[model samples]
Target: MNSLSAPQPVPLAQAHRLLNHGPTVLVSSAHGKRRNIMAASWSMPLDFDPPKVAVVLDKATLTRELVDASGEFVLAVPCRAIAEQTLAAGSLSGRDGDKFAALEFETFPASRVAAPLPAGCIAWLECRVIDEPQVQHTYDLFLGEVLAAWADPAEFSDGRWHFSAEGRRSIHYVAGGQFFSTGEAFEVSVTG
Candidate 1:
């Protein structure tokens, strides 16, 4: 909802497409009076029909702890406009205080989850954690079944992404406070 537009619901079947291009996402979680957001680049779609996803959360992070407590989280695809905030979300420790207030990020409530969706993101995936204790304990990998999905229609709709401007573009983290905004898009046709 950055410069793109207000978010509209993306059909459940098309939710997986939001993260299909591997954009870095803002992972938001809340439990009781506490809430936090972290930037994660290691999330991906795991299923289609039920729309599931996978994300790795380090054991030491507070976001992980909150996720474990509440069993819900939101994965939001941030844009170039909020790249700095996204990096700050990943860099800081939420155990200190409320990162949402400390960083001054605006958010809206998610329909199907306790985690609030960051407003500047291009798309959002609200997920309920699927119970997979072995993988979660061993690898810090959490599996989630997407319960609801939303996107800025100007950026994504009809199961396609068409980023046409700098601020409108999604971001990918590289390292050292640097990020790559999504580039010009082109399509390739299949040939037999």
Candidate 2:
């Protein structure tokens, strides 16, 4: 797939740019014999070096329970095509059973964590928990360190992303099944 965005080296420091626009992400985790997947839009980068991330997971969510017990989770950035599945993940509860199986979802292996990366996702970030236990227990917020990250070569390479089609572009959750594509790029030059 050809992309209009110029390809450049993806520096370790710039990895955060991948999620900077704040697209909704799937949080995957396992505890004992159970595993779960859920959607979250309230996630952001906290630091550059040793890459850190913060995400809000409701305490009542099955995802929070599993992540708290396991101390690890995978963040998968889905594309427009999987938007409905993403919404369903958030609406349903993993307490029932393997949510992925119930949803007929597919997954791929991650290099760092046990949590399987969701299929059809544009990008994947394997994360391990870090500081702010107080926040997690208090606000249902979890902090993590990005251990590994991989992107679909079709949509992303080097340090930049190139969305070739509507279905391939990253999706941003609004509400319910509603979402907005990352949209076209525009830049402004700063004169000092």
Candidate 3:
């Protein structure tokens, strides 16, 4: 795992909390000999049980093209430590060469998907495409069923996130090179 110290184990159900605040993610895909990694900010949870996720990927990206062909990909939550590389991935093309290699990111095998999860990510969600051609062509949106998920216990546990340091927290992309660190958390209890 990619943590300053050993991580803690968390319940799978609470996994959604990691993305609740919306962070830019590294989408990983592999099909036969071709594999690619790209940065995506337009991703969100669509459902809970048998968790489903939706991500917007431009039709032109190598990540999209490979994902469309293979029907599988991994959504890895990158942290502030990789913010610069995240922006670089979004700006460059995977068509020319391997973005992961170019960026020097380490990866490990995902349990359910062929794509490798990028290292230094706080969490990883392996998903298989639930095909919707219309959505893919129309909005560049790919929906998937999360086959498996994992997280670094130091930053996430019990479905809630606790960032001990600024560099270890998740990162949200604005535009260009700007980004916001996953801010402090506060709770609101509803009254009926």
lDDT tens readout by residue for model 2, 74-188: 8877778888888999889888878899887887667778888888777777889986788888888899998887777667776677777788788888875789988986779
lDDT of 1 by residue, 1-192 (tens): 344578999998999999999999999999998999999999999999899999999999999999999999999999998998999999999999999989999888999998899888899999999999999999999999999999988889889998856797899999999999989889999999
Candidate 2 lDDT trough over 10 residues, lowest sum: 1-10
TM-score of each candidate? 0.97, 0.90, 0.93
| Residue 3 lDDT, candidate 2, scale 0-100 | 23
- Show model 1 residue runs off by greater than 4 Å: 1-3
Best by TM-score: 1
In the order shown, the candidates' Cα RMSDs to the true structure are 1.0, 3.6, 1.7
- What's model 1's lDDT at 175? 92
* Cα lDDT, model 1, residue 114: 89
Could you give the candidate ranking by lDDT, starting with the highest?
Answer: 1, 3, 2
- Candidate 2 residue 163 Cα shift, in angstroms, is 0.9
Scored by lDDT, model 3 comes in at: 0.85
In candidate 2, which residue pairs get closer than 3 Å at backbone N, Cα or C atoms, i.e. clash? none
